[model samples]
Target: MKDLLTTTSSIIVILFCCCVLFLGDDADQHLSEPDSEMITARNHKKFLKARHPLAKTTLFRRVQSVRLKDGVLMFVTADQNGLKEHFFIIRDKNVILVKKDAGDMPPDSIKFDADGHGGIQVTIPNTFELDPLQDLLSCRN
Candidate 1:
């Protein structure tokens, strides 16, 4: 009985060591989330941290898509009121708050005024300290 117990313990220890050697600590990092989610979260964190000119924007709801073309990023823009179903352009110290019409293409020129859903003008600050990523994550949890 004693010899059998020792053999079983030895096998268990060997299996554990093999698992630790093969898996490593990084396995725990991806134990819950997949690789793509981790990459997306990091990118989202970088974008929301005042990379754009308009740091005053608020995240009303979760938007689906964000694309970049010709050095410009097209994504949903939100404010204190609600979310917009149109695409807002962010590029080169400017945010073109243009909305997509019911037709195929977006409007050529939106009203460039801050009174409504046009756009806002501001100087890009040296640093952006807000953590909109954490705020949005907390909402999910």
Candidate 2:
């Protein structure tokens, strides 16, 4: 009878240790950020800092062109303002939206044109507007 109790206690102790090790409370802290939010935040940061400051003036000139590749659907507008041009190349959807800043100029217009070869060109005017991309993304196929 003592042998049986000892064996049962050992098994219970082992099980408890396994559970504590494998299902520890520390697991939650290590989780990575969601993909969507990460993408949005990264893109937002790029817009504020202007990854290529010269590219803004040179690449965003009037009638300038911006191309987007597959899996890359969002972009900042050429305008110095904080507007972002989000595109859904899968469905040929495009929209203009503005980002917030303490001291930023407003953008005026956003234009979207598609190339026959799965490419898109976006143009932004001098003023900012609401996130038109949201409405475009919500539409059903």
Which lDDT tens digits does candidate 2 get at residues 1-141? 999999999999999999998877567555544433543664887656543423321133232323334433344555567455655454544423233441322232334444433344545443434343564455465
TM-scores of all predicted structures: 0.20, 0.26
Model 1 scores a TM of 0.20
lDDT of 1 at 140: 24
Model 1 per-residue lDDT tens digits across residues 1-141 = 999999999999999999897787667767856644543654876645534443344432333344444434344545567655554444444353333331422222223334233456322111222233343344321
Clashing pairs in 2: 106-127, 107-126, 107-127, 107-128, 108-125, 108-126, 108-127, 109-125
Top model number, TM-score: 2
Error of 2 at 20 (Å): 1.6
State how far residue 90 of model 1 sits from its true place (Å).
2.7
Worst lDDT run of 10 residues, candidate 1, spans 122-131
Clashing residue pairs found in predicted model 1: none
